[model samples]
Target: MAEIAFPKDAMRVLKETSRTFYIPITFLQKELKYSVASAYLIFRAIDEIEDHADLDNVVKYEILQQVSELFERPFNNEEYFRILEPVKSIMPDVTIRLEEWLQACPMDVRPIVADAAREMAWGMAKWSKANWNIRTREDLDDYTYYVAGLVGVMLSDLWAHYADEKTDRDLAIGYGRGLQAVNILRNEEEDLGERGVSFVPDGWTRAELFEYAEENLAKADEYMKSLHKKSILLFCRLPLALAHKTLNAMKEGREKMTRAEVEQTVEEIQSE
Candidate 1:
């Protein structure tokens, strides 16, 4: 693979958006790193619109649908800018500069990333239309699949492209669900207090949700154990390790792992 410069601005936005992903991405080989970073930022851009505090559900649905339509066609800078113009002023920088992130991907894999993002945007639109109602276990599964599980499927494709590596697609979805479930747990307070949304099922408690996360994480472990590439393994393991530790911390009544604990976990992963 030829060398490609990962954009500095993309890296800066990535670090601002997600510390967990930013750390693992830095460990990937150059081309793979660029591809993964681009994909992540693409998803994060639409995700901000989906989770925006001020946007009405109807407005979110409209914007996300337009985004999905934009991804369906060939890349056009003018079209994207026009499509997003109505709410650009209110949107975050990550969401506003989505075109930059799209162009940053390795050309060969850009379509793959775009297609995955299109599906995710459409899914977000669906959930927003429904007001993000999670009434049952199946609803939770479907919601997570759209938002996060598709991410696993997309990454699996990227791995195959870059490393000639094949992963069990089912386990990959579990990997994403596990991580997303942990996020739901960690943000339960904010999700309810700020957004008035609850990802937990109709009658499920924290313990039930904990069990859900652990089950999917077991699949994530299987997915990681099957990897032969050291870089890929490290990339996958770093987040999984943190997810587990975060769950443990939550169990002990802590909202999340402290900065010191996060650094300690990274060091431990590096040592392993």
Candidate 2:
């Protein structure tokens, strides 16, 4: 085992950028908390570039490629920040000091985080160069896998690192896919209207997309059922519970969960 310290900057960025994720991550203990948070910040950096409405496609590809290249060697604080400085302000605060996050992660966990970041960055670069023309479900799956499915794999790796039980990687991937699908549906208008990107396949009805999302969420439910630790289970369950609720709400034309609904869901999950 290696020494781990929580980076205040990473915590701040995590809280600032994501509320739902911030809650479940708080349930993670010690090094696992730091590892997962650091990993998340790295992914968020890549996502910020991918989703930047103002950046040119060529610029986005170059920045993402630079990100992928940075993880290939030792973490260089100056060069990393310099290369990404153009979009640093728009990205989460944690991304501003990536090297610090790397320093805080345990040695064993650092490689997993770096590898996943490399894969995500590279994939994002590829898609950005293509302008995200997701013409089919396969294209959508490939894109989501780059941005979200890999998150499931990364969390599964973290779960394995903290506990003795092995995680089913496919189920975990499904968990990511499910959540991303819900996001695509929820943000359909914004992604298309603002970003000119449409995640839904042509000829797909809203009901069909909702069914596709639910099927994957069912896999996510199975992933949760396989976990034994209460904390880990809660960490995996809360977002998933919310995601399912979000999908149901979307069917009714709602975009988000109210605080009361979140609290009630927490109670239901805790009671089960």
Q: What is the C-alpha lDDT of each candidate?
A: 0.92, 0.83
Q: Which residue pairs clash within candidate 1?
A: none
Candidate 1's residue-wise lDDT over 1-272, tens digit each? 22354578899999999888998998899888998998999999999999888888998899899889989888777887787787788889998888889888988998999999999999999999999999999999999999999999999999999999999999999999999999999999999999899999999988999999999999999998778898888899999999999999999999999999999999988878
Relative to the true structure, candidate 1 has a C-alpha RMSD (angstroms) of: 1.5
Candidate 2 clashes: the total is: 0
Error at 205, model 1, angstroms: 1.8
Residue pairs in steric clash, candidate 2? none
Segments in model 2 whose C-alpha atoms lie over 4 Å from true places = 1-5, 85-92, 270-272
Task: For candidate 2, give the lDDT.
Answer: 0.83
lDDT of 1: 0.92
Work out the TM-score per prediction: 0.97, 0.93
